[model samples]
Target: MIEIFTDGASSGNPGPGGYGAILKAGSHYKELSGGFRKTTNNRMELLAVIKALEAIKKPNQTITIYSDSKYIIDAIEKKWVYGWIKKGFKDKKNKDLWLQLMEYFKLHQIRLVWVKGHAGHPENERCDELAVAAAKQPALPADLFFEAEAAREKLF
Candidate 1:
């Protein structure tokens, strides 16, 4: 069985953002993080889980992902994403990350559990710390999709 904890943070809405994730399986453990120069918190939230799932090397393993973002957890657990897909994700956000996650769903038995953030949960707090630190780092990579979407919206 694999256990994962994830968190995401942004300096501000549509600002610098990052994701942090911890993956553990038996005696092995790993931490992953990535920062984007500009992005939304929701995107980062979903991306954290994606990064964690990507870190798993074995397929068909049981995996549990813990996260605090309702935007990520509720959407999946409540089966809203599937409905969004059925509608071709028209008028929905984070379609890219959601699609990527759906692909991984085919590879593992995944469960998402929501935890209260900053509520004394060690792993959750650590992931949040990692996310915040990454978001504050200089020379972060651009979130091209977010940037392009922002630019187009600016054109109107």
Candidate 2:
């Protein structure tokens, strides 16, 4: 079984943001993270999970994911994402990330466990630190999807 702990951080709700993920299998561990100059916390949250899943080498693996974002956890666990997918993700915020995540669902047996943020969980804390540090990087790249969406929204 593989275990993953993830967290996301933003300097502001829709400001600079980043995601952190720690993957553990047997005696091996890996950490992943990236930053965006402009993005939402939820986007980072979802991206963390997607990146972690993409890191796995083998398909059909059993995986457990620990996340602090109820936005990501509840959406999957409560079957909301499935419904959204059926509806072609109409009125959805992060359609790109959600679609990317669902692609991994077919390859892995994934279980999502929500953990309280800043609750002293070691792996969770480490993820949080990684996310925050990434968000602070001097020259993060633009989140193209987010920028395009924001631009489109402004025209309305």
The best candidate by lDDT is 2
Question: What lDDT would each prediction earn against the true structure?
Answer: 0.92, 0.95
lDDT of 1 by residue, 1-156 (tens): 899999999998989999999988899889899899999999999899999998887789899999999988888889999999999999897788899999999999998899999999999999999999999999999998889888977899
Worst 10 residues of 2 by lDDT: 85-94
What are the models' TM-scores? 0.97, 0.98
**Candidate number achieving the greatest TM-score relative to the actual structure:** 2
Model 1: per-residue Cα lDDT at residue 94: 78
lDDT of 2 by residue, 6-117 (tens): 9999999899999999999999999999999999999999999999999998999999999999999899889999999899988889999999999999999999999999
> Candidate 1: deviation at residue 14, Å?
0.9
